[model samples]
Target: MKKAKITAYVDAALFDEIDALAARRRVPKTQIIEAALASFLSPDSAEQSEAAIVRRLDRLTRSLERLERDQEITTEALALFVRFWLTTTPPLPDDTYLAAKAKGKERYGGFVETLARRLGKGTTLMKELPLDLPGSTDPR
Candidate 1:
């Protein structure tokens, strides 16, 4: 290899990064600078860069689809639970209504605390159940 020494001026921040990369990779700063310049100047890099971008976008699209599906599942579950609750809950008589309301409030506070603890612990019922279970129509 006929290597000739050349001097070039680089910004201090860029120089620091080059030095850091060289140190981390256990390579000379010249090699890092050469690799960077080669990547910058190569015609093939454009196509390669575009391919990399397309792959990333594909991954992001899949992630977004999964998010949408999850949201749909969550919305459906909440709606069904609310509907069932509304239909099943009987109206309380006026005499015991205040006591019932107090007890309901206490139970609700406990429910909220439990929910917060479960969320903080990252426990989710969705993850425990199989995908097929959610879509099943049969009661059995």
Candidate 2:
């Protein structure tokens, strides 16, 4: 049933608080007042309870954190899997490392260009890591 609007005078402090809440939410003051009345009169107040909303937000935050952690773990697992495949996986005598190298090049051809961009360098299609390491000197 549509109800007519009735004006009731509230205390100055309470009216100011309602105005502040309206400004904070960027909504008209009338809508906020109507929402408060509806919430109070609605049968399933528990569904719109502030406590339930807080719980849902907290749960979502935990879920996001878990996903970030799982992604890191998955990244580590992929790295370890790659290392194991390159080092320990036995290959056919007929199959040479050149074929594997070619496959790798085809798969991750843009890896170097992406790395350079991520390191704050301008994107270059062809890139070579210029690193001088000690103890193992093999210049190829």
| Top lDDT model | 1
Query: Cα deviation in Å at residue 29, candidate 2?
Result: 29
- Relative to the true structure, how large is the alpha-carbon lDDT of every model? 0.87, 0.76
Model 2 vs. true fold: TM:
0.32
TM-score of each: 0.65, 0.32
The weakest ten consecutive residues by lDDT in model 1 span 131-140
Error of 2 at 48 (Å): 6.8
Quote the RMSD, in angstroms, for model 1. Answer: 6.3
lDDT of 1 by residue, 1-140 (tens): 88878899999999999999999999999998888888999989899989999999999999898778778889998999999999999989999999998999999999999999988998765664453586755321
Clash pairs (backbone) in predicted model 1: none
lDDT of 2 by residue, 78-138 (tens): 8999998999977756567788788789768687667767677653222222123345443
Q: How much lDDT does candidate 2 score?
A: 0.76
What are the candidates' C-alpha RMSDs?
A: 6.3, 16.0
